[model samples]
Target: MSELKILIVDDDPVTRSMLKHTLNAHGYLTAEASDGADALAKMAAETFPIVISDWNMPNMNGLELCEQIRKHDSEGYIYTILLTSNNAMEDRVKGLRAGADDFIGKPFNKDELLERMAAGERVLNLETREALIFALAKLAESRDTDTGLHLERVQRYARFLTQELVGDPAFADEIDEEFIQLVYQTSPLHDIGKVGIPDSVLLHPGKLSKDQFKLMQSHTVIGADCLKGAIAKSPKAKFLHMAHDIARFHHEKFDGSGYPDGLVGEKIPLAARIVAIADVYDALRSRRIYKPAFSHERSCEIICGDAGSHFDPRLVAAFERVHEQFATIAERFSEPSELPGSAEPKELEMVH
Candidate 1:
């Protein structure tokens, strides 16, 4: 295993020195902080995935530190371990509620410490899994030459809409921080099934025939089935479950008019409903072989016009509120080649 840089926070110099020496001896890099406050300062300046802090301190205790860490806008997860002699069940509960991942007795055992670190490493390894998921999504996207940054833009739009819906009473029970993150991470896989589409149909330079369009629509099922297989192997992967839902249902219309399964209204998975709006909006704004890119205002009008027919009305309302932000994100990630007047139109490919 590669060495992990850990921050040791405690007011006791001896304990800090001992812990740092033990960690460094075991191929782990160590940094010392006098208290939780000091640790927070260091964290603000540097990235540390693991934090070992004592329960008792002058400025801030370990529990406080854990709470602060959880509240901080860090880009990645931080595994926090609290060191305390207090063995009371209530104290342990308090630490857990404060966001502590693990606890160690005041007189810590070296083997136990290392084992806990290993467990934390395993948790951090989820990051690697998420990266692999995106790579797989990218592989599917590679089949289409015209979808430059489509995945990136769609994920952002989905995340933005989901974030806005967090305040809505109708979705209050559904959307949360984890939901928002999952939408952002899994939205890119919405079209992964397109890989199964034959080039003759997927890359056709003209409008698809009735049979070809039917085959083209099968990409949703193909992608969903691929994720279903992965889910069968790892049933507990929440991201896969969401990705499966998005892949299968993102193309479903809100008014019972969509394909594969005519799931209408709230019956469609909420994640899929949210992604449908995002995907369509980006598709409208993006340049396609058959259609030129639409302006932000024009895109908004089309989306708003189809609020109840193509998208969930609640989500459409949320989109209306954040339409400006969506345009900003689109502009930020827009490919220069996709911009208007940058390139002449190519042979048309049928887009769903």
Candidate 2:
């Protein structure tokens, strides 16, 4: 309803015109592209939430377009519906593998097309929410010297560790498909409170003095306060609530030594516990102004060393099982396939 635009991709001008007119008549905005190549070109100029593409086209085809979109686009997920004459199961399978969300057969029915579009709208709206969450976290990350890659790397690492925890006796109830997904989506904000820390403390190239260190520790509270405000406005948003927990408690240790509340053992939020492992591992591997990046082996030993004191012992076991995977994740930015489809982020872009 917010002036949603649909991109209509087809080689046939007649078909394109008809689809464009039909969408426009229903109070929707539309754009036209002659083929998959043209559609990609259009995307370079602007992003469309929904794309209705024909299966057969000159040069590149709809399937290729969907694959390309899944690979390159991260501003948000694009809901793609293939308009094809082929109704065979194999064709649908191919389209799905290429990342098409829904489909409409050729000689489209006005009613059926509308139904598919409605389904796509629902999916796109969900993606928009995820994008906004990432954008807000990026906003907070911008206040720090480290690139937003810090968030991207941590998100995957958290998700990787969390997925392996599923069904373990300790996390039998807490670790599910949904929990794993929300953690991946919301884990990046663990340091969102750093936005409130002054640069003298946050960006200090040297070791912090006792007072400076104390000031630095307050970032957990700062981030939580920001997310708590958002939660108040959207009381039913589970992700926002999870983000608040992560921002406030990720630094809390399994023992009582951690700050901002000194929650010990199971008292720390499970989301925070998971993110702490991820955040620490990333911090150790990433190069800081004061310290060079630690070797993967050294980072592993440190995390394993802190198992009972700083991290959940069960999660440390999980990390051991996935240590190689964690190292792989550090080298790139991608979430596990168990969550929604992921795209490689080019770099940290500030959320406007």
Candidate 3:
């Protein structure tokens, strides 16, 4: 088992020391906080999956701490338990409403405390699902050798673009902290369907013929079907739903000129639209078998120039605002040989 760190928050030094000693004896690493405010400050500096907090504290109570933890924007879920003297049903309901995962009496038993922590561990372990998702995506990406760090670059690009739109009045209602995180997590799966493409077509050294190109375009549908099955199995998984949207519709164009299903304008999922620009930008900036990497300036010109036709104009405008950041992300992740070089703009075929 991995080292599990638990944060203990209580005003009483005796209680804190006792809990820490007990947890440490059971092979759990521990951190101490004097109160809820102190706990929040420590949490900002480090990740704590399980927090054992006393309900009464001077700076901030355990209830307020639970509420703040829910809003803290950490990457993983924090399983919080309230140590409270009040055993009333009303108090427990209040704790639940405040986001407390579990509760223990003020004089918590060693066995009961350990058992509660075990249950919290089970909940935190579910985060491994994210690791599984990324591994699966990487497996699919491994098939195409030319796209070095393509998934990483696209994930960053999609996240940066989504963050920029948070302030826009048009997307203010749609874009939020959760939506941005989901886009970052699921963007890498956009080309997962390409795994199904035949090696002959996917590994083609030169431009594909019309018939070959038609077959290549089917990757979008293929990837969507795979994710659709996953969604059916885990219908509540929001990340899979967004991944499904990106896989199915990232190739769809703004003006209904794209393949598989030519979804026009807003008909295309917003997540897919954001990913479309990210995918194309990486394609334009990365070296390919048939084309040298285009300079950042040239890539920007092509993407901005296609705003209304090939890409969403609003996203294009957002890209223009943060295009330099996009360049920085590409450079940060690119190998020395993959660095963009000056090349004349060419009428490139639709990037796979």
**Could you tally the backbone clashes for each prediction?**
1, 1, 0
Q: What value of lDDT does candidate 2 attain over all alpha carbons?
A: 0.79
Once fitted onto the true fold, the runs of candidate 2 whose alpha carbons sit more than 4 angstroms away are 1-124, 333-352
Clashing pairs in 1: 193-223
* Alpha-carbon runs more than 4 Å astray in model 1: 1-125, 341-352
Model 2: residue 35 alpha-carbon error in angstroms: 27
Per-candidate TM-score against the hidden true structure: 0.67, 0.63, 0.67
Candidate 3 — which residues are off by over 4 angstroms? 1-127, 350-352
- Per-residue lDDT tens digits for candidate 3, residues 231-275, read 999999999999999999999999999977989998999999999
Q: Arrange candidates by lDDT, highest first: which order? A: 3, 1, 2
In order, candidate lDDTs are 0.84, 0.79, 0.85
Task: Give the per-residue lDDT of model 1 (tens digit) for 98-139.
Answer: 667788898999998989899888877776766777899899
Q: Which candidate achieves the best TM-score against the true structure?
A: 3
Alpha-carbon shift of residue 339 in model 3 (angstroms): 1.9
Candidate 2, 13-66: lDDT as tens digits: 999998988888887899999999999999889878899999999899999998
